[model samples]
Target: MTKPVRKAVFPVAGLGTRFLPATKTMAKEMLPVVDKPLIQYAVEEAAAAGIEYFIFVTGRGKHVLVEHFDHAFELEQLLGARGKTEALETLRAAIPAPGTVISTRQQNPLGLGHAVWCARAFIGEDEPFAVILPDDLILSDTPAIGQLIEAHAKVGGNVVATEDVPREHTNRYGILKVQSDDGRLARADGLVEKPKPEDAPSTLSIIGRYVLDATVMDRLGSIGKGSGGEIQLTDGMAATIDDGVPFHGLRFEGTRFDCGDKVGFLKANMAFALDRPDMRDDVAAFLKDMAAGL
Candidate 1:
């Protein structure tokens, strides 16, 4: 029987330099998308995909993130006194059950590869796992991680969620070199992180979600730094691909927002605000006033 991919790792150690000043004191993962923080969306996604245990590879100044997943007595009591049943439901929905969530520190700002390596102890030996980057806020009916997990069930190898990016924008992501094109599922021969446009293998960029084999932990071990003098996760995955281990990309149906980028973060906020009934009106009016000035 294929080992079930029941655990997920979230690499949230970044210093959110992009959203600095605001992020200097706070973790970007704690920033709210609607009512829930970015990390909450990712955890919920893993849970929806049938993942049982969640591992958060966190860093300094990320205490609020861990707290967000825990119970809040003051707020619960306030809601209880006010008879706010509906409001309480929303709060409960955002938080995962205690003990199901866990955290480990990624002491060094090494890179994504090192962050995953930090979770190795929690991951243990020879079971498949998933990784989600909070920066990639996937907008879809189903969580993007769920799509990758479903694909992993059929193939029993590494699976990465992919989406078409403008050919001109390939440098912004980890690009996949395809061995065969099967549309929604591509036979990935290799992957390169943030390649120059001329060097990029294909326009299908790897997003945040990945159903990774625990073997990847070995590949990540003491791996040499790539382009940015940072250990890239693509390097490890690329090693697996070259060894003839099957790897596939799932072209999930969704809008992806690179919440790590300033413009992308603003767009996500606007898009989410527009989706909320109460905020839609005020947010629209605010945008209109701001646009008229522009």
Candidate 2:
């Protein structure tokens, strides 16, 4: 029987250099999309996917990322006493149950691979785990992480969320070398990290969501620095492929927003605002007027 994917690792250690002064004090993951933070959306997606234990790989001054999932007693009391029943319920709903969430620190800004390595102990030796990048906010009817988990169950090895990018833009992502593709799932012969347009084997690029077997952690520990002189997770995963591990890419159903970029952040805010029933009409009207004025 395949081991159930019970825990998820969230790599939230990056310094949001792009978002500057605003992130100087606040963790970028805490920036709100509509009303909820980016990290909240990732967590909610993981929870909906049946992830029971949430492990956050954090860095200096990123305590707010963990705190967001913690209960605020004073604030809850104030809401309850003021008879704000709806507000209180919403607040309570966001906090995970006691002992289910934990955080571990990545002491250096090494890379995405190192950040995930920091969560190795929690993943143990044989369990399958999920890694979610809060920077990639994916909106879909079914949670994005859940989609990867479903693919993992069917394939029983490492499965990454993939999307087709323009061939000219393949250099920006970890592109997959297709062994075979059947519309939704593509079996990868190999994965190349940010290959040049001409060298890219396929247009399918790996995104933020991943369902990985624990063995990949060992590979991460030994791989050399890649790409921008930092340990790259793609390198670690590609190594597993050489060991004959099954690697697949799932074309998940979602519209992904890269919230790490300023333009992308603004777009995510607008898209998410337009998604809410309470605010959609007003937001659409405002956008229409703004477009007309421009």
RMSD of each: 2.0, 0.9
Residue 69 error, candidate 2, Å: 1.1
State residue 104's C-alpha deviation in candidate 2, in Å. 0.5
lDDT of each: 0.86, 0.92
Regions of candidate 1 where Cα sits further than 4 Å from its true position: 277-294
* Candidate 2: tens digits of C-alpha lDDT, residues 1-294: 578999999999988989989999999999899889999999999999999999999999999988889889999999999999999999889888899998999998889999999999898798899999999999799998898888888887799999999999999999999999999999998999999999999999999999998889999999978999989999999999998889999999989999998899999999989989999999999999999999
Clashing pairs in 1: none
User: Model 1: per-residue lDDT, tens digit, 205-293?
Assistant: 88888999877888888567886887889898888776666889899988888899889888988988887898999999999999999
For model 2, the stretches where C-alpha displacement exceeds 4 angstroms are none
TM-score for each predicted model, relative to the true structure:
0.92, 0.98
